[model samples]
Target: MVIVGILSIGFVVLAILLVLVRFVFDLRLTAIQQEADHSQLFRRKINHLRKIEQARHIRYLLIICLMIGIGLAILIGSFLVLMDKQQKLTAQNQIDHERIIYLEKQQKQLMANIPLKKYPEEGIGLEEYEWEKWSEEKKDVNLQRQIESAISKRSAQYFDSFDTKVSLSTPKTISLQLKGYTDDDASREMIKSNLDAFAKEAEKVSQLNNIHVRMITSVSKEKQVVYSVNYSRKKSEDKFNKQNVSEQNLKNSGEKG
Candidate 1:
């Protein structure tokens, strides 16, 4: 666009210069005619007037051409920009499609690795065991789904029994902490039983162990219960720490394995 604008301006300047040169030539002709006595001063003035009219016509034509050139330049530039944007959009869409396909393939592979339990429905199975057979990918998905389901179910059950509101935070490490009020020991025990059952069901489906249930209460006003479960994989540091302690004990007793 800028280049076209520059070219258009240059052409306009050239046209103006040409008109000026032609006017100067007409003046020279008038002078020659006057000196040669071939034409009177009035005739030379008339000729000069004719040249002015022609110059005006040329100037108008030049202005029209300049406007048309500028309009074309702007239009062409806009079209080029639009085409470039469309190409970028097309490329981005292709990239997104490929990424989606790759993720779907990854999901299928992970699901294949897990041991799926057959249900009455064909092509549909329940994840029955503690997701130990699942790959890291499948396990993560299963774990998140399980945790969310448990939280939703437990939260509803807790709220139903007590008029006091109960809110559940996001479950992390298979632990849920609840806060509310209970009528009596029976009510508290009921809530505890409900939470314990939920934890057991989760344990059956996921690789977790040693589920712990803890509750805190301020008399009848509020009560909070926390459920914690350990993932199946033990941390390397914990194992190493245990081994080191055992080795130290064995050395003190002068025994070796």
Candidate 2:
């Protein structure tokens, strides 16, 4: 497009130059004829006028051609731009369609695992895990007890107003999500306090456990609010060793497998 535009401008400039040159030549011819005899000068002047008229006609044609070239160039450039945008839109649509299909397949798989095959409108739906199927040799009873104790202590403060949900990820990691709260200093303080309690409990449960937690609070102008807390736990090698020892002791005691 840029190159075409440049060429168009060059042609227009050339046409203008041609017109100027023609005008100068006619003026010079007239000046020369003015020094001659009247009759001869008149004949030469008439011929020069004819030549000037022809040049004027040629200049007009050049101007018209230049205008047409510029118009065509602009039209072609606009078409190319439109075509590029269309191609991008088409590619984006395809990507979105593929994403939707993938999510649909996942949804179907989840539905098939449930006996009822029912879908909920909100919240995550998960397939329950059977603890009995897990290897007893790898079980960490002491760590489990510690986590339960922490949850119990934290829940005692706001169990009536808030529901508690706990999820365990790995041997060391735990994630917590809290919902429903008015956006106020009190709610914020409660969240902070609960988080601090959880952190403290996690620290006491195993010396080598580190906790990472986040809280999200949403409040509306009408005083309605919702909040959630998410936490993860990571256990160090020392804690893992201690857990293994505890498991061995449990196995040696001949406890329930």
Best by TM-score: 2
- CA lDDT of 174 in candidate 1? 38
TM per candidate comes to 0.30, 0.33
Count backbone clashes in candidate 1.
Answer: 0
Candidate 1 C-alpha lDDT tens digits along 94-138: 999999878755654453343322212221122442344332443
Candidate 2 ranges beyond 4 A from true positions: 12-43, 46-56, 59-67, 74-78, 81-91, 94-257
All models, RMSD in angstroms: 19.3, 17.1
Off by over 4 Å in 1: 1-51, 118-257
Give the count of colliding residue pairs in each prediction. 0, 2
Give the true-structure RMSD of model 2: 17.1
